[model samples]
Target chain A: MSSLGSKWKPVIVMVINDRKLRFGQIAARIHVISRKVLTDQLREMVEDGLLIREEFKELPPRVEYTLTEKGLALLPILNLLEDWERNYETKEVLAEA
Target chain B: MSSLGSKWKPVIVMVINDRKLRFGQIAARIHVISRKVLTDQLREMVEDGLLIREEFKELPPRVEYTLTEKGLALLPILNLLEDWERNYETKEVLAEA
Candidate 1:
C-alpha cells in the first residue's frame, strides 16, 4: 500500500500480525508513538482494509485490532523489511554486486 | 536499520540509490518533505554509512548525494518493499496460506 503511507505501518503490522490486540496493547509495542498518531494510522489501515477492528459491548468498551487477510498478506513484506534492517545495521560496506 | 529509526529513511534511500543528487534534487523527488527534514535524514544516512555526500567549492556551492556500498546493499531490500507494497495494494484480501 505505497499510496497508503504511514511511518509506523511496518512496525505495527509486524507486531500484531498473527494475533489480535486491544487498542492500548498495540500502542504499547511501538514505543513513543502518540495516541493521536496511532489512532490516525489505525483508522487509515482499517479504511484501506488492511486491519479489522472488532468491538465488544463490554463496560469501558473493548476493541480488538487484528490483521485482516490484507494485513496478514503484509507479513512477508514486513519480514523482508525486518531482515533488511537487521542486515543493514550489522553488515559493513557490502561486497561487489 | 531497526534500532536506527527514521520515517523517511526508506523513501530517501530508494530515490538517491544509484546516481548522486544535490540537496535540492533529492528533496524534489520526495514531495512535501521540508529541507530541514531532508537535511536531517541525509545526515543520518551519512552517519549510518548508507549515503555519501560530496561537496565542492564554487560560487553558489555544490554538493551531491549517492548511496554507499551499504546503501546499494539496501536496493534488494527496497525492491522487496516496493514489490510487496505493489502487490499488497493490487491483490484482494489474500488467499489463505
Candidate 2:
C-alpha cells in the first residue's frame, strides 16, 4: 500500500507502463505535478521496488524509469480504478445535467 | 480518484463496510487516526457520495455512517487492492528473511 499511497504514483505508473521515459518527459506528461514532488515520488517508487532507475553515460547524462515486475502487477488494479473513476465522473456529469 | 485520494478514506471505508458505525466506533476501530482527521475524512466521504451520514436524536446526539451504493461498488476494487498488497508484503517479508 505504501507504494501506491501517493496519488501521483499510480498516474506515474500508468504513464511509464511498457515504455521508458526520462524525468522531463514524465514531468511534461503530468504537468500538474511540480518537479520537486515528482522527483520525490519517483525516488520513493524506486525505493519501494516498483520502478527501476537507469542512468546512461552520455554528455549530459541520461536517466530513464521503467516499471519493475511489482509495478507491472499494479496495472490491472489501477485500470479497474480508472474505469470506476470514469464511470463515476460520467454519472456526476449526468446528475448535474 | 479524488474520493480516495486520501489514504485514510479507503481504510475508513473498509472499517465501516456493510455496517452502520458511529463516529466514536469508527475512531475506536482505526485508532491510529486522530479524531479530527477522521471527522474531516468522514465528512469528505459523505460529500463524495461514498457514505451516508445519519444523525440520531440520542442522549449525546449520535451520528452514524454507512456506505452508499457507490461506496459498496468500491469494495470489490478495494478487495483486489488489499489482496495485491497482502501478497506484496508477504514477498517483501520473505525476501528480507
Candidate 3:
C-alpha cells in the first residue's frame, strides 16, 4: 500500500480514473488539496507507472493526466472502497467520534 | 480513505483480515513495523470501527485483534490490491526505477 498510501494519491486516482483531466480540473474537483501537494502526488504516480502525464503544445500550453492500464486497474478496488465508505463507514463512525 | 490512509493500517488489516491474530502475530507478519507504531495503528483502527481488540483473562492475559464487519468488508478490495501489486505494479515498476 506504500505506493498508494498518501491521503491525496487515491483521491487523485479517483478524479482521473475514467478520463483525462487538466491540472486545474483536478484541483477544482478535489478543492481541499493544496496545489503543491497535488503536483507532488501526480509526479509520484507518474513515476510509479500508475499515471501518464501528457503535455500538448498550445497558446498557453496544456497538460493533462490519465491513468495508465495499471492505474485504470485500480478503479474497481477504489469503487469498492467508495461503496464501503458511503454505505457502511461514514456517518456512524463520525457520530461516534 | 482517511479511515484507511496510514501505511501500516492496510498492512495491519491484511495481516489479520481472514482470522483473529495476537499482537505478536501481526507484528511478525509485517516484520518492519515498530512495536509503538503498530500499537498506535491498531488503536486507531479499533477507534474507527474497523477492528475489535479483545482481551482474554488467561494466565498471563492474552490480547487478540479481529476485523469488524466494516473491516471484513474491506477484504475484497484489499485482495484486489494485493493482486494488482503482485502482478502489475511490483517488478516492472521497480525495475524501471
Candidate 4:
C-alpha cells in the first residue's frame, strides 16, 4: 500500500498481468488518464524495480513494458484490493439484499 | 485500494482505529510530515466522504477527526494491505528467511 503507485496502478498491473504491452496500449486500457500521468507513473514503476522497459530501434521506435518478478509478485495483493472494492467500496449492492 | 489515500492513509487510519483524534494528534503520529500536507490530505479524505471533521470554535481552534462509516468500512482493506506489505512489499525479513 505504501508503494509508489497512484490509484490506477493496481488496475494497470491487473490488466498487464503475465504479459507485456506497448505504451499506447497500456494507456488505452485505463480510460481518461492523460498520456503524461501514465507515462510518469510507468517510469516511476520502472525506477521502483516493478517494471522492465525494452526499447527497439524500429521505424516507429518500438517500446514495450513488462512487470518484473517483483511486479508479478504484487498480483495477489492487487487481487485482494479488487475483491475488497467489489465487495465493499463499490456502490452496487442492493440495500434490500 | 482506489480510495483517495496516500502512502500514510492506511497507517493513519490504522493508528486511529475506533477512536476520534485531533489534528495535531494525527500529524504527530506520522513523523516528518509537514503540518500543511497532513492538513491537506485529511481535508481530501473528508471531501472523499471517508472521514468526518469536527471543528470547535475555541480559543485554540480545536478540531477533531474521525472516520465515517464508509471510512471504517475500509478497515478490512487496509488490514489486508498491511498484511501484504509486511509479508510481501516491505524491505524486511532476513535473507532466505
lDDT of 4 by residue, A1-97 (tens): 5564367677777878889999989988887789988888888888666789999999999889998876787888677656755665445355335
TM-score between model 1 and native: 0.74
* lDDT (tens digit, per residue) of candidate 1 on A1-97: 3533565877788889899899999988877999999998898888777899999999999999999876787788667666766776556545323
Per-residue lDDT, model 4, residue A5, is 37
Of the candidates numbered 3 and 4, which has the greater lDDT value?
A: 3
In terms of TM-score, which candidate is strongest?
2
Give candidate 2 misplaced runs (Cα > 4 Å): none
DockQ of 2: 0.66
lDDT (Cα, tens digit) per residue for candidate 2, span B1-97 = 6678978988888899999999999999999999899989999989998999999898989998999988988888988889988888899899999
Q: Which candidate is the best by lDDT?
A: 2
Against the true structure, what is model 3's DockQ? 0.75
What CAPRI-style quality would you assign to candidate 1? Answer: acceptable
How close to the true structure is residue B43 of candidate 4, measured as C-alpha lDDT? 79
All DockQ scores: 0.26, 0.66, 0.75, 0.39
Which residues of candidate 3, in runs, are more than 4 Å off? Answer: A90-97, B57-59, B90-97
Q: Quote model 4's TM-score.
A: 0.74
Quantify how close model 3 is to the true structure by its C-alpha RMSD in Å: 2.8
Which prediction has more favorable TM-score, 2 or 3? 2
**Model 1, which residues run further than 4 Å from truth?**
A1-7, A28-37, A91-97, B1-7, B31-34, B91-97
For candidate 3, give the lDDT of residue B46.
96
